[model samples]
Target: MVDVVACGELLIDFTPVQQKEKPGSIAFEQNPGGAPANVLAALSRFGKRTSFIGAVGNDVFGRFLQQTLIRLNIGTKGLVLTEEAHTTLAFVHLDETGDRSFHFYRNPGADIMLREQDVNEALIAQAAIFHFGTLSLTHEPARSATWRAVEYAKQHQRLLSFDPNIRASLWEDLEEAKALALKGMAKADIVKLSEEELAFLVGSEDVVEATAWMLGQYDLQAVFVTLGEKGCFYRTRNNFGTVGGFQVTAIDTTGAGDAFVGALLYQLLEVGESMLDIPQATLEDMVRFANAAGALTTTRSGAIPAMPTLSEVKSFMEAAR
Candidate 1:
């Protein structure tokens, strides 16, 4: 059985190589990316049986994306290649702090053209976890596809993993984005959010209270709030703690959060179905390992291309201590 199955966008990210210092000119390199795709790529590096359910175009760029995922051993049986629209492309701009801003070129890209009928229930039901983000909810057909898959996962009792991975520029309406994000949260058993996303949901910057409110408002088993350079905070029904971040001079922050989430899920899979029963100490150790994975990712560039392997993450963790 597949350990995890994710349904969302699979697109290319053109990341700039030169920063503010090189003001004369800027250069970009095409990288395989997408929030859900990045997570699956990170898991695949750790030898997890992961599958992705999404769409790309039938064009050359889409072919490159398909081959990249296949090379990483991510199942693409649920991937739809359509001629209805060209593949989506995102241009990434990284600031001096390594934080990123995005500009997307998707006037109804092939990813958003994913129809409800394109989602395969049999393929999704084989996985223990169903992962998704609100990016798929910005447009139709894909929105319907996402909802159908969520319902199928619920019926099959798969662990629902939600990451808002919110990029507000993609949403036409801020209120609608909030409402749709909350809708996804309601269906999630496990949530991983960036600090900004947490504040968006709770309307407060206080993470402790926001996490507490989320755990109470929804029947969530666990909540993880990623704090970038500060590492991350995780809370379960019975336990909560802050795991300090690894020290690294980050060059690019893209896919770092996805790497962290993927590492956490990798540890969860190793523990089998009894996830909530994991010891608090063991949970903290897992968070540290994940933080290492994320920090290592930032030292490099791109999304899927920069994801560190299990051995690399372990070595980073060991050397950090």
Candidate 2:
């Protein structure tokens, strides 16, 4: 039985690394990445039974990605290797603040080639939570596949978790992106958004006002807005509060948000589908642990490679206190 099943892109991230011998030159370090995959990696580290539903090319990079998930103990039975398109590759550029920008080589990537026929309904039916992002919705076939899986999960009474994970560069039109993002939110029982994403979706800089707008417009059980170093704000149907973040010297903020969402979902598993009934204090504590997980992730370099184990997160949280 899977605790969480994620459906979306799986690809390689080429993170920039400065060359020691050649001061002016930069080298790329290959790491397995993709928002949904990173989230599953975090959950696998927490001892959850997680599965991935996506596609990769039948190439070396694809093979590496497949092995990486297998090594992490994240189920790959739903993963597809196709020759329709090459595996997607992203080059990550980090600013001084460790915030990242992406340059993708996915004009016809294998991830977008995932067809509705590729979706595994059995996998979606067995999972307690079905998590997805808008990346797959940026293109065809995969978009239909994602919707099929989402509707199936909904019909099966599974908790739906949505993270917009917006990449402005990936979308051809900003309005279309916003529309599809809102469509995904309407189906989600829980949502995780970055501060910028909140502003982009709602057109408001005020977190309180924007979140209130979300709760009013959507039939959501809970919503989370991550504030980077400052921490996160959470709003459930019954209660709402803020959770302070852990202070860490971040080297790469690549998968911090994914790790945070993964950790939060891990805690949500204990409550089953009763997310709306969680006490404010308990929800705050969960967010605190998730913040620690995210902070620990940024202290390192890669996404999946940087995910902290359950013991590591617990120890870090204890030390912080």
Candidate 3:
């Protein structure tokens, strides 16, 4: 049985390499990406059995993503290929300050073509955790399909995990998008968000107040707030703490959150850790391990390529201590 089954988008991220002398000109590097796929790959690399459920185009990019996931040891049995639409493409440009910007070339891309019937309820039922992102909920059939998966997971009494990964450009309106995102959060047992994400979602500048407000409103089992480099802060039903991340020279932070989230879920499932009433020590241990995984990912490049193996994470953790 798969420890986690992730459902959502799978696309290509084209990163730019600028010329040293000619600042205006740059070369592009193709990388396999998509938040859900990154998480699944990370979990698989961490020695967890992971399966992915999503749609991909019949194009070269789709085939490349499929081969990439297989190389990471993620099961691709649930992947659906659609011939009507092309695979989604994200053109990423990083400025001199290391700030990233995106240009999406998706109009009815394969990722958004996911249908309700495409979701395999039985596969989700067999998994320990079900993870998804809000991007799939922005369109028609995929939106309904994502909700269907959530309903099925809830029916099976499995853990529902979510990461909003909100992109303002995709939504019809900010208010409507926030409402829909909150609906997904309500169903999620564990909600992971970056500091900026929390502020934007809650409309607050104070991270602590925003997180505390979300915890109070949603009645969630656990809330995890990731602070890049500083580490992760978590609060459970009755426990709370901050786990420091391993010291590392970060190169590309593209997949850091996915690595951390996957490792966190893997540790929770491996140890049978409960979200209902988790102990403070257990939370710390899990976050520390996750932080190590995230830190290790930043030392490399790309989303799927940078995910560390279980042995690598262990060695890095040992060296940190």
Candidate 4:
């Protein structure tokens, strides 16, 4: 049985190495990416029984994505290869400060063609945690497919996790996107968001106030608010803490959030502690480990390419201490 079943987009990101000389110029390097895909890769590398559900184009880029997931040992039985569409591509650009921006080329991309029938009910039933994101909710068939998976997961009483992973450019209807994303969040047992995402959800600029509002309004068991260089803030009913991020000359912030979430999930699964019963020291250790994993990812280039293995994460944490 898979420990985590993640459903959503699986596509290639062509990240540019240099900015354009002019406003409209283009430059890029192929990088396999997608938020859910990156999380699945990270979980698999840490030896979690992970499954990915999505669609890919019957093209060279899709082949690379399939090979990458299989090499990492993630279950890809639910991945559909379609000839009717091309693979989804995100043109990623980084400013001088290493902050990233995106340009999507996703009209009729294979990922958006995911049908309700593409989701595997047996896999969702067997998985301990069913994870999904907001990107798939931006369109028709994919939206139906992802929601169907979520409903099935809920029916089986499985733990649900949601990450908005919002890209404003992808949605023609921003209000609809926000409503749908909030609906997913309400279904989740665990919810994670970046500082910006939290602000958008709560309509507040203060982190503490935003988190407080979430806790007061939602029936969530856990929530994580990632603070980039400041690290992460997390709360469960009985435990709350913030771990300072590791000092690193981050070359790219591409998959850092995914790495952190993946590592956090891996550690939580290993420990299998009741969130309410977790000791302060153990929480600290878990946060430190996750922070190390995330910080290490930024030192490299791609999203999946940058994700550290469990051994690598352990080594980095050991040396840092």
Which rank order by lDDT, best down to worst? 2, 1, 4, 3
Residue 303, model 2: Cα distance from true site in angstroms: 0.4
TM-score winner between candidates 1 and 2 = 2
lDDT tens per residue, model 3, 87-163: 99888765543445678888878999889999987789889999998889888889999999999998898999999
lDDT of each: 0.92, 0.95, 0.86, 0.86
Report how far off residue 210 is in candidate 2 (Å): 1.0
Q: In model 3, what lDDT does residue 174 have?
A: 80
Please provide, for model 2 over 1-321, each residue's C-alpha lDDT reduced to its tens digit, 9 standing for 90 to 100.
999999999999999998999998999999999999999999999999999999999999999999999999999989999999999999999999888999999998999999999999999999999999999999999999999999999999999999999999999999999999999999999999999999999999888889989999999999999999999998888877788898988889999999999999999986564887778788888899999999999999989999999999999999999
Best by TM-score: 2
TM-score of each: 0.97, 0.99, 0.94, 0.94
**Which regions of candidate 2 deviate over 4 angstroms?**
none
* Candidate 4, 249-311: lDDT as tens digits: 877788888888788888888988755567877877887888889999988887999999999
lDDT (C-alpha) at residue 97 in model 3? 38
- Which of candidates 1 and 3 reaches a greater TM-score? 1
lDDT, residue 247, model 2: 91
Q: 1 or 2: which has the higher lDDT?
A: 2
Give the higher-TM-score candidate: 1 or 4. Answer: 1
